[model samples]
Target: MLLYIHIPFCDSKCHYCSFNSYVDLFHLRESYMKALSVQLAYELKRFKATPGSIETVFIGGGTPSTVRPELYRPLFETLRPFIKTGAEISSEANPNSATSSWLEGMFALGVNRISFGVQSFNNEKLKKLGRAHNADDAAAAVLRAEQAGFKHLSLDLIYGVENDTKVLLAHDIEEAFKLPIDHLSAYALTIEEGTPFASIPDVANEKLALTEWFLKRIKKRFATYEISNFGDYRSKHNLGYWEHKDYIGLGSGAVGFLKDTRLYPTIDVQAYINDPLSIQSELLSEASIKTEKIFLGLRSIVGVDEQILSEKEQNRASLLVKEKKLIYENGRYYNNDYLLSDELALFIEQ
Candidate 1:
């Protein structure tokens, strides 16, 4: 089983972020951590699963580094009883707050992987994105993590910004390769409704060429295991989700999935703190799970199983294979085009 814990506090809010995170919620950090520990203990016992059985644990959110690492000590001690050998524990941190001490403390507490939110290397671009970290801060923080003995370091990059040029994209990729990084996630800027960038026109479609170009360059070093994620090291936490593995989601704003049920904890920060186990759950039908498998598989390296699709769907997929749009090998159908995968999956399913 996979595990996800959300730390919903941020030092500052990014303009385009829509995640369930809060700014200026520092006063509640200690209390939230305490509440989270209680909920985790309860969930583990209720689920009838040992912590050691959990393969991956991803601690994500507003900015996990913003919280004091020492506050996490108690939770680690609680988890030690069930944490198995060779488990991959990951945490997300913004470059601005991922200090040397913070990185060290987390490492000492069992966090082996670090995913840094370094959207861009350009200071002006970072300012526009409302990121608190400067370019130098990003570089310095990463080196510090490396120095702290983290072997699994991944960097996130946002491409397809308004009027983003080829030179700009190349420079970002070039700068990224200079760091001691193993994984990279390149995503197009999305104007989610209610975000600061929502009023802006979507330029992702217009920037496909640049995206393709950047991929061509970056792929020389990193493998394209997924549509957006690439690297020498693949994130087990991420791959587990796409594979539809059973997982436990702890903390407010976190989601978990079992055989048929999807659990969501309270999104209201104060309410979640008051009652961290107050989770709302949704039931997933067999058809829903089947559809999700197709969608997620075609979008990543996880190709869909042959028997999962109906005869008609298989025929359509076979036709696409004949046309070289899909590749069928090793008893499964795989997507050849990330951009066209969604449309292709729909057509085959239909």
Candidate 2:
């Protein structure tokens, strides 16, 4: 089992972010933490025994690093009884908010991994994205995390930005290589409807092609283990999700998938604080689970099981194998390259 905790507080919202988070809610911190404890306790009671062996714990958020380190003490304490020994505890930190003391405190609290959101090293791009940290801050933050004794560190980068040229992309990759990190997650920028970036002019299809080209180049430089995520040490918690393993999510705006049920909590912070047990749960149909398995399996280096495909699909696979677009060996099929091609997956479906 894997556990996820959502901390919904940020110093400021990024222009392209649509995650459920609030800015300047320091006053509500204590109350929110208390509510989180209550929610976890309630979930524990509801899911009896809970297997007792949690493989990973990922604390993601609006900005977990922005919260006071002392506030996290109770969180670790509450989770102690449930976490298995040697569990990988990870926390997401924004570059600007991650201080030396804060990083040390998190490590002392059983967090073994730290993922920093260092979107880009370009000052102009950082400004356009509304990120609080500059390139120097991002580099310093990683060094600080390492000095604080965090052995496992990961960094995030965004590609496919309207202004991202090949030269800029190369520079970002070069800057990332300078840091001592075990993991890297690079994603194509998508403009969600509610995000501030949505109002900006959309990049043309040709620009998107360039984005893909840049991503391919990066993938060659850094091994691509999964779609959008690349690392020397891949994220076990996220891998669990891609592989269809069960995970429990806690806090406001948290979503969990336990066996067949897809459970979600109230999105409103106040509503969640008022009634901790009000969860919206839905039992997914069998077909939905199977479809999910296919979709997710295709996204990773581990392709779908041969048995899942029909005879026609198998024939198509043979054609792909001949064309050198895919390879089948040791009872598994894989894309010829690590970077996934959506077109290939779509063609296989047809």
Best model number under lDDT: 1
Worst 10 residues of 1 by lDDT: 199-208
Every model's TM-score? 0.97, 0.92
The residue ranges of model 1 lying beyond 4 angstroms of the native Cα positions read 202-206
- The Cα RMSD of model 2 versus the native structure comes to 2.2
Cα lDDT computed for each candidate against the true fold? 0.88, 0.83
How many backbone clashes are present in model 2? 0
User: Compared with the true structure, what per-residue lDDT tens digits does model 2 show for residues 125-240?
Assistant: 89988899999999999999999998999999987776688898888988988998988898777888898877884631226567677767767767777878877787889888
Error of 2 at 172 (Å): 0.9
- lDDT of candidate 1 over 55-155, digit per residue (tens): 88899998999998899998888887676789899999999899899999999999999999999998888988889998899989889999999999999
Q: Pick the candidate with the highest TM-score.
A: 1
